[model samples]
Target: MDTSKVSSLEELKDLDMDFINDIGWAKVMWDSLQACLKKSFLNWVDTVLTMSQNEDDVKEWRSTFMEQFEDRCYELVTDIRELHEQVLVNIEKYLNKTQVLCKMLQADMPVIGQHKLGLYQEQFQLKRQMRELEQMVEARTSEVNQLRSKQLELCKNLGREPILIKDHPLPSLNEISDLKKHIEQLEQETFDRLEKFTTVKGELIEIINLLGYTPSTQFELAVITGEESDFKITEENMESLDLFLYNMKKELNNVKEEIYQLRTKIEQLWNMLDVDFVEREEFRKKYVGDSLNTLEALRLELKRCESLKRANIKVFVDRLRQELVEIWKLCHCSESVRYEFRFFDSDTYTEDLLELHEVQLKKWKIYAEENKDIIALLNKHHTLWDKMIELEQNATGADRYNNRGGKLLKEEKERNLLSKQIPKIEANLLDLAERYQLRYGVPFLTFGNTIESYINNLHANRENAKKLKLSARKLQKEATAINPSTSHMTSKRILTDCPSTDPKKYKYTPRKVFTEPKKNPKQLQVPKILLTTLSKSKRLSVERKKRLDKIRRLSRQKETRDSSTYIEFQNDLSNRVDLRSTINVAVDNETVVKENFKSPARQRGTTPKSVGKKSPNLPNKLTAVKSQIKLIF
Candidate 1:
C-alpha cells in the first residue's frame, strides 16, 4: 500500500509502536483521521444516494455509522481531561514556587532595605548639617561685613583709610586672628597708658589743689602742649611726661615749703601779739585806736625786732584801754576819769610809761576793792531787772491773751513784787553811789542812767497800756452800738436792759396762750364799695370772697400792729392776693385787704395755731415784710 493512503487496520498494525504509543501524536492523528472520515462520509452520502435504490436502508446505514463514530470519538476524551487537570496542578505548583522564591529573595535582601533607610537618614542628616553649615557661613559672612563696616567707621573717625595685608572684600581667618591680636595689644597698651596718665594726673591735680591753683588748664598744658601737633603715648613721651611731672612736683614742694615758712612767720607774729591768727586779723580790721603802728602795720613790719616791739606796744595799749574801760564800767567813774584817759597816748609816754602803768594799776586795785560789794549788789540788781523785764515781756506777749485769770493774777503779783524789789534795789544802789562818791571823791558804778531809762520805759509802758485799754473799751462800745443784737450777753448795757434782775428770769420758758383780741365791729364790716365790687367782680369766686372776708375778720381782731404773727399773716395775704384786682376793688380804702383763697379745711380755722405749729408759708411772708420794713427804714 501507499504510505500516505494507508487507512486499513493492517497498515495501522505495521506502523511503529513508538509512534502509536505517543499519546500527543496519536491524539493529533486521531483528530485528523476523524475530520477526514467525516469529510469522506459526507462526500460518499451523495454518491450512495445516487446509486442506492432504497432510501430507508441508506438512512438506517447513516444512523448506524454516526452511532459507532460517536462511540469511538470518546477514546481520547479522558486523557484530554486528565491532561487539563495536570496543567492546572503544574500552574499551581509553579505559582507557589514563584511566591516562595519571592519570599526568600525578600528575606535575603533585608540589608538592602536597611541600607536604603540608613542612606535616607544619612541624607536627612547631611541636609540638616548642610543647612547648619550654610547658616554658619551666612553668619560669618555677616560678621565679616560688620567688621568691615566697623573698620570703615574707625577709618572715617580717624580721618584715614584702613591698612590691610590684602585688598579682599572679606578678611581671611588668619587676617581676622591677626587683627584681633593687634586690637587686644592696642587695648592693653592704651589701658596701660591711660592708667599711668590717670595716676600721674591725679597726683598732679592733688598737688595743684594743695597749692591752691586752678588745675584744669594746668593739667591740660602738662599733658599736651599747644605747640605739639600729634600727641602719642610712647616710651619717650611718657619719660618726658614723667620728667615734667617730676619738675611740677618739685615746684609744688618748693611752694609748700614757702607756704610753711610764711605760716611759721604768721605764727611768730601772732605769738608776738599774744593773739591767735583769727584775733590778729580781726584786730587789724576792727581796731578803733588812733595809732600809727596798728595791728596791721605791726604785722607788715617784717623786721622781727621792730615788729615785736610795735606789737608789744599795741598789745600793751590795748590792755591798758581795756582796763580803763573796765574800771570805768565797774566804778561808773566821774567824767574826769574818762576824760583823763580818753586821749592818753602811749607813744608820748616813753619815759613815764612805767609810772603811768603803776598809777593806773594802783587806781584799778583801789577801785576794785572799794566797789566789790557795790558790784555784787549791782549784779544782783541787774539779774532781778532782767527777770522783771522778762516777766513784763511775757505779760505783754501773745501768750498773755490765752492766759487764764489765775495766771494773770499771778503775773500781776509778780509785777508788784518786782516793783517793790526794784525800788528797794534802786534805793540801795543810790545809797551806795552816794557813799562811794562821799568817801572816794568819785562816783561809784551807779546805774543811775539805766535805772532812770528803765523807770521812764515803765511809765511809758503803763501809759500805753492804759491808752490801749481805753481804746479797746471804746472799740467794744462802738461795736456794741453797731450791732445791739450781737452785743455780749454779759455786757452791762445788755444786762441793764433785761427786765428781771434775777438771773433765773433770763432762763427760757414755755410760751403762754396768745388770744386774739375781740374784733371791732366797724373794722370787720367790709366797705360798701369793696363788698359791692367783690360781689360784682367775675374774677372773685365764692370761696375767694369768703377767704377775703375771713382775712379781714382776722385783721380786724388783731389788737397790736407790732404783733409779729399778725404782720406775717398780713404779708402772706399780700403775697398770695392778686394785687391788680385787689387794688381795683379797694382803691379808695387805705388798707387793702388782699387774701389768698385756701382749701375749705384750712379756711375753717377761726384761730391761729401755736407758734411751733405755725404755717411754713409764714416765714416767706415775714421775709417780704422785713425787706419792706428795711426799705422803709
Candidate 2:
C-alpha cells in the first residue's frame, strides 16, 4: 500500500490497506490524546484570557476607525490605479515624442536645420519621463503583490477551523491491549471495594443491640431482681413478661398454620412433624405439665401455631418488599437490596466509600460553581477580544496610511531640493541659449515667466486643498451631530414626501399643506323645546327634563294602575303645570267650546233647536250652570 504519491482515486484501495496496517487503531488512540491536549490547551488559554482586562477596554471609535481605514484603502487603491494609467500615458507620450524627434533628426541631419535642436531637447525630456515611469511601475507592482497576498491570507483564515493536533504519533497493538487490561483491572478493583460494604450490616446490628436495653421484659427483670446475688431480677418488669409470652404464643400459632399448609401442598408432613415434635414436647412440659398426654396435646397446638406463623411471616415480607419498591421509586433511587447482595463485604471498603462520597459531593459542587463563573468570564473576554482585534486592525491600517504619507512628504521634499538646483541649471541653459541667439542673429528664448506662473499655481492649489479639508471636517461634524436625532424619523420623512421629487429637499423645506386636516362632524344634537338656539348648558337641561318626563309617561302607560287614581293624577299634573310665559295673554275674543247631540225624539224628526234668547242675569246664571256642567263632565 503506497500513500506517498496518491494522485488517483483508485489509489484509495492501497491507502485503505495502509490505513489498516498503520493508522486504523492508532488513529483512535491518537484522536483521544489529541482531544485531551486540545482540552488542556483551551482551558489554559481561557484561564489566561479570562484573567486579563486588556481586551475589555476597546474604545468606541474602533468601528468608525475601521470604516475610515477601509475607505482610505479604497482611495489609495484608486489613486494607485490612476497613477498607473498616468504612467502608461506618460510612457506613450514619451515614446511618441521620441518617434517625432527621430523623424525630425532624419529630416535635417545632413543640413542641421532649426528643427534638429528642438527635437534633441524634446528627446532628452522624454527619456527622463520614461525613467520616472519605470521606477513608479516597479514600486506599484511590489505594493500590489504585497496587498494581494495579505488579502488572500485574510480570506483563507475567515472561517477556518483550528487544527487541534500539532504533532501526534501512532499507537501499537500492545498499547491498546494494555489499556484494555488496565480497564478490566480497574473494574475488578471496583468490585472488590464494593464487596467490602457487608461490614455495614454488622455495624447496624451493633447499633440496634446498643438500644435494646428494655427493663420492662420479665427475662431482663429476672436477671436484675433474683434473690441470689448472681440473679438479676426487677419486680417492676414482671407484668411485661406475661405480654411478651402471649405475643410469642400468637406468633408460634401463626407459623404452625403456615407449616401445615406447606405440608399439605408438598406432601412433606413427616419432615415437618420431625422438626416440630421434640420442640413442641419440651415447650408443653415446660409450660403446661410433664404428663405424656398433656405434652401430646400441646405439641399438636404448637405445630398448628408454627405453620400459621410461617405463612403470616411470608405474606408480611412480600408486602414489605412491595412497599420498599414504591418508596425506592418515590425517592428516585435504586433499591438498597442491590447493595446488600452486591456491595456488602466484611471489610472497611463500604465505610470508606460513604466517607468519600460525603467529602467529594462538597468538592464537586464547589468546582462546578467555579467552572460556571470561569465560563462566564471567558464569554465576556471573547467579546472584548473580538472588539479589540477589530480596533487593532484599524489602527494598523491607519499607521500604514501615515507611513505612505510620510514617504510622499519625503519625496516631495527631495523634489523641492532638486527644484532649488534647477535655477542654476536654467541660468546656464539661458546663457547657452543667448550665445546661440547671438551666433545665429535671433531673439533669446524665455522660460522664467512660465516657472513663476507654475509656482503661483502650486501655492493656490495648496491653499484650496487646505480650505477643502477644513470644510469637509466641518460637514462631517455637523452630519454626526444630526445623525443620532435624524435616524428615527428618516423612514417617516421618506413616506410622507412625494416619490417624484428629490429627497434632499425634504431635509430643508418640509412639505406643507394649505388646508388643515378634516375632522369628524360633531355628534347629532338632542331635541330641545325652549328655543331655536340655546346655550349648551340650557339645552342640555331642557333635553334632560323632556327625557325624564317622556320616561315617566311611558312607565305609567306600561303599568296596570287603578283607572280612577290614574285619571286624578293626570288631572293634577295638567293643573299643576309650571311653564313660564314670555308674554301676557289678552282675551280679545272669547269662544266657549260645546258638545251637543240629538235627542231620541229629535232623531225621528231630524231637527235641532238653540237656547239663546235670554236676559243678562239669566245669561250669567246659565254661564255659571254651564261652568258647573263643564267641570262635572
Candidate 3:
C-alpha cells in the first residue's frame, strides 16, 4: 500500500504474491505482475540513461564555470597588486610631505618664541623707562616748587611785588635768553649804582670826621681831609652810612650855632672896646685911628660870615639831596616819585643876607620836623621788630629747668600775645606806608622785609584753608547725595564707643524663636469626646461676615466720595466754560455797540450801560445758570 518507497524493478519483482495466489485469478495476477515488471525495467533503463546525460552536461558546465572563475581571480590578483603599488606610492608621498611639514614647524617654533621673548623684553624696558620718566618729572616738579618758594621769599625781602610762579609757564629758550640779557643789564646798573653810592658815602664819612673841631678849624680840616680822602666804601660798608650822615648833620648844626655865638661875642667885645655909639665921624675923631680899623675889621667879619653861610647852605642842600636820592633808590620808589624828584635842582639864595638866613632857618626847621617824625617811626618799627625777634629766639632756645611752671606759663602767654599783635602791627605798618605814599607822593616806613614775609605766609595759609574747606564741602555734598541714610549711621557709630571685636559679642544679631518640636501622628493622643465636641465653625463664620461687612462699607464710602468729587469737577468745568463764553460775548457786544454808535455822545451813553449791565453781571449770571443746569442733570 506504501508504493512511494519502491523505485527499482528488482524491488518490484521481490514483492510477496500470497494474497493473489489464494484468489481464483492468481495466474492472471502473476502474469500481470510480470508484464508490469518488464515495463518498469524498461522505464528504469531510460531514466538512468537520461540522468547520465544530464550529469555529463552538468559536469561540463561546472568545469567551464570553474575555468572562467580561475581567469577572473587571476585578473583580480593582478589588478589588486597594481592598486597596492599605487597605494604604496601615495603613502610614500604623504610621508614625505608630512616630514617636510614637521621639519618646517620644528624650524619655526624657536624663531617665533625668540620673537615673542624679544617683544616681552622690549615691553619691560619701555615700562622701566616710563617709570624713570615719571620719577624725573616728579623730582623736577618738586624742585620747581622749592625754587618758587625761594623766589617768593626773595621778593618779600627785597620789598618788591612778588612774581606769581603758578601763573607763568616754564621758561623757553627765547625767554631764558632774554632773561639772561636783562640780568646782565641789571648787574651792570647795580655796579654803577654801587660805585656812585660808595663815592658819596666816603665823602660823607670824611665830612663827618672833620665835624669834631670848631667851625673855623672844621673848614680847614675838611679842606685838608678832602684832598687826602682816598677811602673806598663798598656795598658791605654802606649799611651804617645813613646813621653816620644823620649824626654828622646834627654835629655840623651845633658847630655852626657855636660859631655864630662866638662871632656875636667878638662883635660885642669890639663894640665895648670902641667908642662907636656916637656918630661915625665923631667916634673916629674921639677914639683916634683905632675906631676906623675896628669898623673895617667888623665889615670884613660880616662879609666872611655871609660867605660862610652861603657855602654851608649850599653844601647842606647838596648833601641832603644826595641822601634823599640814595634813600629813594634803596626803597625802590614808584615811577611817580622818581619822576617828581628827578630834577631837584634849586636856585642859589641871592637876596638880603638876613632874608637868606631866615630862609635857611625855615628850611632847617622843616627838615628837622620831618626827620623827627621819620626817626620816631623808625624807632617804633625797630622796637616791634626787636620784640618779634626776641620772641622767636626765646621760642627756639632751650627750655629752662628752674621755675619751669611760672616761666612756661609766662612764655606761653607772651608767645600767644605776640602772635596776636604781630599781624595787627604788620597790617598797621603796611597801611601807614600806603597812606604816606598817597599823601606825600613818596614811600615812608616801607622798610621792614620780615613783615612782608609774614603777611605772605598768612595769605597762603588762608588760601590753603579755604581750599580745604571747599574740598570738605564738596565731599560732604557727594556723601549726602550718594547715601543720605549711611551718613547718619556713620555719624552714630562715630559718636558711640568702638564696637567689640570678639566674635561672641555681636553689635547686632537677629532674634531667635524657640519653636516646639512637631508631634508625630502616632504620638498625638486626641480624646474622642473632645473631637466630637469641637465647634469653632460658627465663630469663624461670624468673623468672616464681619470682615466682609467692613470691606463693603469701605468700598461704599469710596464710591460715594468718588461720585461727589466727579460731580463737583463737572460743575466747576461747566461754570468755567460758561464764564469764558459770557466774557467773550460781552467783548463782542461792546465792539458791536461801538460800531453801531460811532458818534462820541452816543458811544459814551451806550458804553456806561454796556459796562454796567453786561460786564459786571455776565459772569455771575453764567455761573448761576451753570449751577442750575448742573442741579437738573
Candidate 4:
C-alpha cells in the first residue's frame, strides 16, 4: 500500500474487491493524483489567487475554469498519472534487476540512483543508466571469477591454498589491478623460493657430507634429494628446509668454533714457549682441515702444551702478565689498574694462577676491542703529545736554534704538525666519548678517570703552561731592556728553534698524504696510414713497423682480455695498477646522506661553537678525501 513502491494496477490486487468498489472511481482517481503529486513540489490543486470578489470578470473566469476542468485538468492529470506509474514500474524493474545482479556478482553498484528524482520523461534515461550499471557489474564479476579460478591454479602449483576472494563492494579498478599484481607476485615468489630451495638443499648435502653425518628423518632425506619425497613448495616445507639447513650450519659452526679455540690455545702456548713463526706456520699447515682427525691432533697438541706449561709455569705466567700489561698500556690503564690482578704478582705457579691470568687477559682484550676506536684516537693523541713535550724540553737548549742541515726547520715543522694534530685527535676523542657515555650511561674511563675530566685537566694545564711561557718571555724582555750590554751575549730563541725527535730515525706515518688513484690518460689512437703502411714502396722504418705490429698485437690482446674476471689475467693501460694507496681514509659506515628538513636556522651566536656542532650530517674531518671531493666545488 506504500504509494512510492506501487508501480502497476496489479499491485493493488492485494486489497479486497469490496474495498476498491467502496472508494468510487472519482475519489480513487483524486487520491491517485495526490499520491503522484506527493513526488512534486506542491501536492494539492487549488483555486487561482487572482480571482477578485467584486470584479465582473471574476464570475466569467470561474465559469470558464469550471467548464474546462474535466478536459484541461482532469483528463491531463489522469493521463500523466498513468504514464508516471508506468515510468515508476519500469524504473523499479531495472533497479531490482541491478540490485539482484550486484548481490549475486558480489560487487557493488557504482551508484544506486534515487527513485522519483527526475521528471516522468527523464525516468527513461535513469532506467537506462541502471541497466547499463547492471551490465557492467555482471561483466566485471565474470572477469573476477575467471581470475579467481586462474589464481587457484597458480596456488596449487605453488602448493599454496588461499581463501576465497571477496572483492571490495564499491571499487572496480583497484580490485582487478590488485588481483593481477598479486598473481604475478605469487608466481615470482614461487620461482625464487624454488631456486633458493635447490641451492639450500645442495649446500645442506655438502655440509652433511663434510660433517660425515646421516639424515635420520625421511623429511631430511627429501630436503637433501628430490626423488620419491613428499616435499611440497608450501611455507611449512620451506620452514622445515630452512630449519634443517640452519641446524646443519649451526653444527658446522660449532665444529669451526672448536677448531678456532684450539688454534688460539695453541697460539697462546706458542707465545709462552717463544715459538718461532716458521714452526707455527708448519703446525698450521700440518693440521689444516677441521676434521675429527684434525680435532684429535689439536687435542693432543693442547695436552702437550699443558704439560709443558706446568713444567715452566713461572715463565708462562710472566708471559701472560706481559700480555696483560700490553693491553693495559693500550687502554691507558693506570698503575693502580694494573695492580688489581694480584694473580700476576703471585709467586704461586699453579694451573689455577695461570688460568686466572688468562681470564684476566681475555677480559681486557674484549674491553679493548669494544673501545678500539676510542683507544686508537687516544693513542694518536698521546703519541703526538709526547712528541710535543720532547720538542718543548729541547726548546730550552742553549744552542738548539742553529738550522744546520735544515734540521731545526724540519723539527719546527714537525712540532707545528704535532701541535695541530694532538688537539684535533683530542676533540674527536671528546665527541666519541660523549656518544659512548650517552649510549652506555657510564663515563668513558682511561687512567682510572673519566676521559672528559682528563681532557679538561689537560686543557687547563696547557693554558697554564702558555701563561707561564708568556710571563717568562716578558721577564726576559724587561731584563734585556734593563741590561742592554748582556742582551748581545744571548739570542732570543723562539719556539721555532724547539728540538724534536731525531730526523734520521724512521717514524710511523699517522696522517698519511695520498691522492685518489690517478686516472689513465686516454689511449693515443694510431693513424690508419701508420697502422697499415699505405704502400711498402717507401717502406716504413723498422722502428715504426715494430710499433705498428705491437699496437696490432696489443689491440687483439685488449679485445680478448677485456672481460676477464681473473685478478692477475690483465689490468688497465696503467703500468703501476698493482701499487697501493697508503692513505688511511675514515669511511662513513652505511653512509646515505639525507636531506635535512628545513627549520629556522639556528641563531649564529646563541650556542657556543664548541658546544654545538654545525650539522649532524657533516663529515667529521674535512681532510679526508671522499668528504673533500664530495662536497667541494
At residue 587, candidate 1 shows an lDDT of 18
Taking the tens digit of each residue's C-alpha lDDT, what string does model 2 give over 1-633? 223222222323333534545667778876886898689657755765666646433232334444554555456656767877776676467786544443422221112223544444544566765555455444544544444454343323232222121111112235434544544554454344333322322332333243332345555445334433332112222234334444444544544555444434323223323446666456435644222333345467656755654545433333334444443333223344335433222233333443333243344345335334333333343344344333322222212112232342343344345434433333333344344444656422122222222223333332343333334435544553366344224423443442322212321221121111124346322222221222322223334345434533542343223112223422342342221111111100000001112234343864334332332211121222111100100
Off by over 4 Å in 1: 1-311, 333-337, 344-358, 403-417, 440-633
Indicate which candidate wins on TM-score: 4
Per-residue accuracy of model 4 over 1-633 as CA lDDT, tens digit each = 323223433333354446566668956886887787564313212243344555556557655544554344545656888988888887677667767666655556545444535655456665676677667776777788888888887787677875467744533577678888888888798778878887888898888877777888988867766552244678887888889899989988888788889989988888888788998888888987766567778899899988888999888788888888899988888898777776667997898998898889889999899999999888777778767655644433322322245444456577668756765676677677767867887767788766555655554444344344444445544664576444433322211232322223312132321112123445322222212222212222343335434543653353344222211211221222212111111110011000011111222324323232233322222222121000000
Candidate 1 residue lDDT tens string, 1-633? 233222322232245547656588777887899899989888878777787869787877777666555545443454665766765565455445434433422222112223444433534444444455445445656766666665554444334445553323345567667766655555566567767866776776666555444535553575643333244556666776687678778867665555455545555455646656676667457633322233334435435534464536655555666667777677656566666764455565342563465478568768678678877777777787667656644543322322243454566567668757865665665556556556766544343343223333433443343334334435544654466444333333433554432223433222221112124674322222122222211222344435434543543343123123324434544454322211111210111111122223336854333223433322232332221210000
Winner of 1 and 4 under TM-score: 4
Candidate 4 regions exceeding 4 Å error are 1-197, 216-240, 273-283, 291-293, 296-300, 307-312, 393-396, 406-419, 439-442, 449-633
Q: In model 1, what is the error at residue 526, expressed in angstroms?
A: 73
Ranking by lDDT: 4, 1, 3, 2
lDDT (Cα atoms) of all candidates against the true structure: 0.48, 0.36, 0.43, 0.59
Superposed on all Cα atoms, the candidates' RMSDs to the truth, in angstroms, are 38.2, 62.1, 55.8, 35.0
Model 4 lDDT-worst window of ten: 588-597
Per lDDT, the best of the predicted structures is 4
Query: By descending TM-score, how would the candidates be arranged?
Result: 4, 1, 3, 2
Q: For model 3, what is the error of residue 443's alpha carbon versus the real structure, in angstroms, after optimal superposition?
A: 6.2
| Greater-lDDT candidate between 3 and 4 | 4
